[model samples]
Target: MNAPARLRVAAGQATSVPRDVAANVATACSLVTTAADQGARVVVLPELFLTGYAAEEWRHDDSLALDASTGSGGPDERLRPLADLARERGVTVVASAAVRRALDASTLSAVVLTPDGEVRAPYDKQHLCGLEEQGFFTAGDHGATIVVDGWELGLGICYDGSFPEHAASAAAAGATAYLTPAAFFTGSDHRRDLYYAARAIDNGIYVVFAGLTGTCGASSFSGGSAVYDPEGRAVARTGADDPAVVVADLDIAEVRRVQDEVNTVARDRRDSLGHRERLEVGRAG
Candidate 1:
């Protein structure tokens, strides 16, 4: 079999229309088109790009109800056209949407759309931040790793990035790249920037992070969408306040080189030690 194609990924960072599902979907489609024109093989949009991140307002709005797709049906019918666009352009599109999980009546979630327009398995944000999303959304029980064009891709939402375990778990699951769709605020931008880079270093994988800009509800987002190489170096980054598409030609070969140099995975072999520690703790108790 021929080797998988090396993907040129684009992280589309822009201001979203809060509570405006139609406009948001249109904007995302436009961005995807633009990215395809620019020769991007894979495009990643911000978390909850379709409805913005106004959790409480979105949860109550009835009009927004139409945008929510059942997990089994793929993307909403309105957004179905995007899937055709992806196929036409031959680009794997990863866009976020506010969705209703059919399994539980009370649960609303965020999900990713594949280029074929299929909803890849959903990864609801496992950790909700502050009061905004706490009661409004239900945390997802599992994480997903998708392979697109031979690239092992891991998915996570905004608050999920703050925790090391989330990225670590993805890395452990053989993810070569971690993709985060975030709506990060101003003061927290620097911390997030550093944390993403650190996660790359720790996991020895590339990180493609996109964040929303402008104001959503009472919160203002910092638009520092970036791509980090396996060595935890920023290969390409946008300004914290700029609305633009950040593109990077990632070298899959470099991933292996860095992994060999750092050897974090090979050297950190304490698997048996963990069991020993647990046993010791049990005895002590």
Candidate 2:
């Protein structure tokens, strides 16, 4: 039999200020290290943690982009040092930023760094929020899912999590875990909490929300980072406390048990998604 499948994950919650790339990177690196030291192999940060969400500088600057149209975000410009951080700390990091496509347009991206310090292919956020059009970021064509170790992981940004379609799509794609990196402000917690549990239980998968914890412009980021198990129960969470790492251990065996017994995904997987005017394979809503 295969060795028992287990993964230790951490959601790193911190504030990212506008126009402060170095500081944001430093904070992420520190949190990544802390998570690694705490035995977490995977560490996730809030959306746009590199340059801060809603930062005008990111919209205007091409060099601030994570990847260029040439298909590669060359090491230095892409914060290749983050790979070094992962390599040194023996952890994989998931974080988001902007990838410049043109002088006036960029893609909101979720970047994955391997333990070997390699920048893995990034997942661009497919859904944009209200008034985000005021910014220069472009909507990605589709969402993405990837396998990490034995776990199939899916990526979602802030607003993307609100729609059941995104998580359902990942689940249909064989994602056993979903991570949403958000910079949600006050009054958004309840909805997020509701869906986080709903999505996990509906799909019989684990979910993690890595949230921010401070103010930006007129908004106040509420730092309620949390993780939920396949049963849709909160396994770990930050008490809206200061910047912190909310860590948890997930088991693939448990996921299998849930599927074999409870098996919700199997019952509704086909009903929600389809091809050609057909509902998406995983989209229930």
Model 1: per-residue Cα lDDT over 7-45, one tens digit each? 688888777877777777777778788878888888888
Per-candidate TM equals 0.85, 0.88
The TM-score between candidate 1 and the true structure equals 0.85
Model 2: runs farther than 4 Å from truth?
1-4, 55-58, 133-135, 263-266, 272-285
Per-residue accuracy of model 2 over 211-276 as CA lDDT, tens digit each: 877875456788788899998999998856667998899999888888778766644566634556
- Clash list (residue pairs), candidate 1: none
Q: Per-model C-alpha lDDT, please?
A: 0.73, 0.78
What are the clash counts of all predictions, listed in order?
A: 0, 4
